[model samples]
Target chain A: MSSLAVGCRLRVAVLVLALLGAGAVGGGSTAHAADDGELTLDSIVNNVIVGHAEDGNYLNFDPFATVELPRIMVARTADGALTVDLYGSTKGLLKDGTYGLVPHSEGEGGHEEVITESSALQEAFASKAHLHGDIVRTSGHVVADLSITRHLIFGLLAMGIVLAIFLVLAQRYKRGVGRTEAPHGVLQNMMEVMVVFIRDEVAKPNIQGEKWRTFLPYLLSAFFFILMANILGLVPYAGAATSNIAVTGVLAVMTFVIGLLYGSKDHYKHMFLGPPDAPWPIRVILVPIELIGTVMRHLALAIRLFANMMGGSLIIFSLIGLVFIMNVLFGEAMAFGTSIISIGFTVFILLLKLLVAFIQAYVFTILSALFIGISVEEHEHEEHADDAHAEAPTSQTSGALSDRLDAVDDAVDDVTEPAPA
Target chain B: MTEVIAQSLVQPDVGLIFWKTIAFLIFLFLLYRYGWGPITEAMESREEEIESSIQRAEEALAEAKEIQSENKKARREAEREAQRILREARESAEELREEEMAKTRDRIQQMQEQAQAEIEREKQAALQELRDEVADLAIEAASKVVRDDLDGERQRKLVNDFIDDLPKN
Candidate 1:
């Protein structure tokens, strides 16, 4: 059979620069980058994370291509000597006879089996196979497979996208786009809605003393970065980095650290010492619970993001997989009939995934902001509490906006009424 | 085997995490420095401007209202002044008419008195003429009677007595 890996022609730079990869999962990949053989359920699902690597390094959904990234690995021989090496690609790595690729089925991870010879290696690098695998050393094993992954490349691409958007926006702001006047256009307006929402709806309400200002940059970055990544996931062949637990874990860990760094003395005290008023028995129980709770919540934070994104991708892949399964079971005509249902379900899920993308990004950032706010929150006696602090009015021209809107609405009606008449 | 796959799904890749930590740190730093600051500062600046603009608009509205009220008051004041002037004009016109009537009445009374005085003088003169004629008739009658009468002086004295005896009223 042809090489197992399947994909559309693509590159990170193009995705970053063009910022449009909707063609990845759509007609583009199916028409231009279709695999030579039939697709398997496992292969389709696995393809969500690992793009096809057969034709050097390629981004999955687009047509642009980049050179294969290097693989950095830790290997051990039968002598127990450890050596770290980098290769231009998996093909190059296998050429050394020092390391070989094993299919997940023959491997310990997903589908399993045994790999004995060069034939198995070829099978492992199937049309649906990825470079992320058990790389076996001759008579030894890969102690650490610290390879630069597809997800990592996408992650960097997502980052580059975020940087690109804001850099242009920063220039616009410097030229006084939203400053001297109200923001205009789709990009500015779209960005303003999120920024305003985060500030007024999320950050300000959580952080006190108007200290949301200090955390605004971090909050905005987290929101936009995750948002961009989540959006990129919806692009046909392009997926989200947040689908990986490692990426989300890093993000959560950042939240935990930031929370601690800016944490009030009382927060630490409350965590370790428990409520001072509680009896010693209760205190003993409460302290451990609080400590465990803190770690668990952050872990939960990471898993929640990963699971949601991963589930979405799985569903889409599975829905598409149904057609191929039908083709194998029945005939070509049935496959076409099955595609109708599959495409319908896929479209529905794609729509849901779009909404989910924004929600998950907002959720992660707001939660992080909340945790930080909690850490920095001051717990004081009721008698000493000040009640004067209230929500600052969001906009002075809130009424003006409506008034102007109404005026514009009337003006439009006036201008158009005569035409219809 | 399914469990292994399930476990692998969630298993965080160490290499990814290692790179992610460094990458995320840079992201936060670079974003804080470059991306977020200008955008947020501009927003805050715009917000302040809107607030001030609203304040200015409110002030302008109030000023306009005040000017309108003052204008209404002035208009009312002008109306009152006009009414007062009208009333005074009517009062002066009536006074002028009355004064003219009073002067005309005075002149008419004065003319009537002068005519009355001249009529009285003329009536006295006519009475004198009548008296003279009577005297001439008496003299002629006396001359005819003197042929059988006393003297002329006696006749004159008698007439004078008669005239004096007539009622002076």
Candidate 2:
């Protein structure tokens, strides 16, 4: 009990420290605010957004104070050989001569202008120097800025956590923890339940046949990864990797690739030629529509996950930003009063976000399964269909076939049955 | 504000994508190999074990039930056989008792007959003895009278005459 109290005290202390640090940054912005006549909404938006990969600034729970991540850039030198530049932080990169921070434009009223842009910055922008948080000289271009950003750090952290959990679970399984006997303890049981759920509920129902085994590993990994990332984001100082479009894009692309690569001939035939029974004119029209629809589905999968995660965080940030906005507009007393209302809404959204996190992960995983299922589905062709119909009566003598037919009949009867008098 | 928000929302950096893809793929591969593969396999095996164990238990229960029924049938048959043996024993015992009673009745009848026969034989013998005595007394009286009247020759002739007259009567 005493240890618990001490832990709570430590958390409170850290929260207080974070708030103080944020307050300093927020107060320091008043100098810029004085020049701009007043603090605009742009600052709040900028604070909420993850600006660029090269930007060392990370959005923390405190809202104002940002954590700087390490900057890494691979630039091509004049000799055409690759050179890697490493800095402890973005500030260190600015101190180095190879790259410079592009100035933010004050009145241009966009993310490009969120930071006051100087003439020198405009010149750099004209010269085609990439101004993504850090300037890369357009003449001697950088191969890739594989810098470790805040999101990347969080992403890796999420991966590390997932790996740690599963690796232990794997070891336990190797030692026959859940194999020969009933699984004991919360962790083992939880892992078993999730694995079973994904296999039985998600993969089996969607991706049917023996093929489910092939995709089960990928599906399980995607589900756990997304779930972990979403939950991590809800923590005080962590970010949701799925909130980034790029991450979701990569995930969606993987699903698309799997579908494209492993799709049955019938799958492609259906998409490209429509149903064989359809008229030629109708088939031609349907083919392009189906093709577009397939692409759109994949795109939607990525966007849906990304938007849901991003939107939840955005709402929470906007709610907290209201308190600061009130402080600027109505003085300290009104701002203090508004903090209660703002915090109330923020907490409410936070709870909703927690639910959304699980739901989005589920939605993403199930949809991927569905898409893969459709691609890999085996269907009896028209000729085979006729043959099956001819053989149906004879096949009915088999007990298994008859039982299956009975089940189907029962399902049909249930659907068609009227209300009892 | 909208432009700033839009830029933030829409911006995608190559570096982040590249890193994310790499990290995610690595995670997927590592977990697929070590984590998910073994875990799923374990769960599948566990399910199969449970199912087989239940089936085995059911089979054992059925066998036990079958054995119990067979035992009951044998016990019933043994009970019936014992009842039949007891009944046959009781019937033989009753027959033996009746035979002993008949033998005792025949022995009593034989003894009574023997006793009656002896009594009759004795009566006949006594009767004969009485008759002989009477005869002897009569003869003696007749001889005394004769001796007083005549001489020895005349007495002999009178006794012979009396024996002859008795023979004729």
Candidate 3:
């Protein structure tokens, strides 16, 4: 078995080297005509990273087969009128010539060359205007390009899958399938385990009290959506939606909104005025710090998830890119030798990325719960303290003063004994 | 190089975020209504069922244990009652045997006393007959002698006196 594995590894190394060799040769020949270097690290990064959407451009898993997604664009005409164009494919838009692909660089000349014909397919692709964020030309002026990018498509796909799975599970539960009987299939059982985990482990402990239930649906959706998006990104040509800062940002914003909306009077007071018992001098120093900390925490939440996911994919791409890099830098034989090491590291990192996918999802969910928990936490101790002070007797009567002292002691005991769990 | 990396890393498209938020909110609402709501309720109901079933089983086990102990107690009581009855029966049988033996002894003593009295009376009668016979004999003898000599009156007197002397002998 060990020998067989070694032989397989040897074969993979050879295959990788051959591919890299071909890429190196092809890239060298094409570099003169094309603005972008083919198969270079930058090209690989651009290909892997989140980019703007191009119409009808499918994710290219292989050179022969692709998964096509719809392109929706908002463009402006020569008269400064807005046009919303929906095309079945980027090829259709290119054929129409109402919109043209802008070049990445205009060379020494200051004029930007826009590709308008199907004959300029190579130049059009080099321009990459098919990507969602890149601006397209309508009568030689740049227009707003709000198209569905690759990551957005994958994000929607992930959401759809999550919805479909849980919807079925929900229907089964409603029909008394899982309710009255033991959960029948793997999908139902797994979904139940996850839901229960989120409820018991994530929501209950963090968001305390009945408020957890109100926030549970949001937490569950976010967790599953992120989890599905992360897993789907591992597929050959799919983009990780969580890897995109915009998606994570939106999630964080939602969490922030929920936190603010549900925040208790005490929560806001603590943020703006420090603790009520603290001296005036200390309050002045602490309030702004506390307020800024709240925003920063949410910001960190977004960036953490985005960075972890993007970092994992980037590492894997870099590892794979190393073979091509070595082929270009060193001789083909050296590149072939390096492929073995490169592929090994790539496989290892891929596994790590899978683990990171689940962890990041869990982290994001729990942190959101924690923030919500802090916001909604009731100030029972403070209320008890206030009640105790209110019942204290006036100092005009000496006997009543002693009784008031005892009352204060009893109140302190009451407050300390039933501290919130 | 760092700028390039940073730009790639932090790029947030406004359009994407807007659509994502809408999609996510719709998903959250739909799932809450149809997916999580029913699922969580079912799980909770199922958990309650399992808990109640366990409690009932425990109660039944406790009841069974109580009955078993009661049966044990009852069986022990019955065994004690049976032993007491057996002991009472043996004691009664012993008392009856003793009473019969005493009755038989008293009857034997009375019969021996009666037999002794009868023997005493028979002996006395025999003696009287013997005495009379002897007296008769003596008279006859006396008459024979007197016929050759004296009178009858003197013979009767002599016989009466002779009977009396013979009793003394």
**Model 2 stretches with alpha carbons more than 4 Å out:** A1-40, A48-67, A76-83, A109-134, A381-421, B109-169
> Per-residue alpha-carbon lDDT of model 1 for A299-337, expressed as tens digits?
877876776777676666656655664454445897899
TM-score per candidate, chains pooled: 0.75, 0.75, 0.77
What shift in Å separates residue B20 of candidate 1 from its native position after superposition?
2.0
Sorting all predicted structures by TM-score, with the top scorer first, yields 3, 1, 2
Which 10-residue window of candidate 1 chain A scores lowest in summed lDDT? A8-17
- lDDT by candidate, in order shown: 0.69, 0.68, 0.70
Q: Of the native A-B interface contacts, what share survives in model 2?
A: 0.63
* Top lDDT prediction, candidate number: 3
Complex DockQ per candidate: 0.23, 0.33, 0.33
Error of 2 at A299 (Å): 0.9
lDDT by residue for model 2 (A1-421), tens:
1334323322322322243345454444444543554354344334433332112334444445645567778889877988888887655565455665545444343444222234554554443232235455444777887777677777788889989999998999889988887787899888777778888888897775889999988898899889898888788777788888878888999999999999988778777977555679999998998899789878988887777777676656656766665566456897799789879977877787777777777777877888898788766544436744454433232234236434543543352232100
Best by TM-score: 3
How many angstroms is residue A364 displaced in model 2 relative to the true structure, after the best TM-score fit? 1.1
Q: Report the C-alpha lDDT of model 2 over B92-120, residue by residue, as the tens digit.
A: 88888888878877878887787777777
CAPRI docking class of candidate 3? acceptable
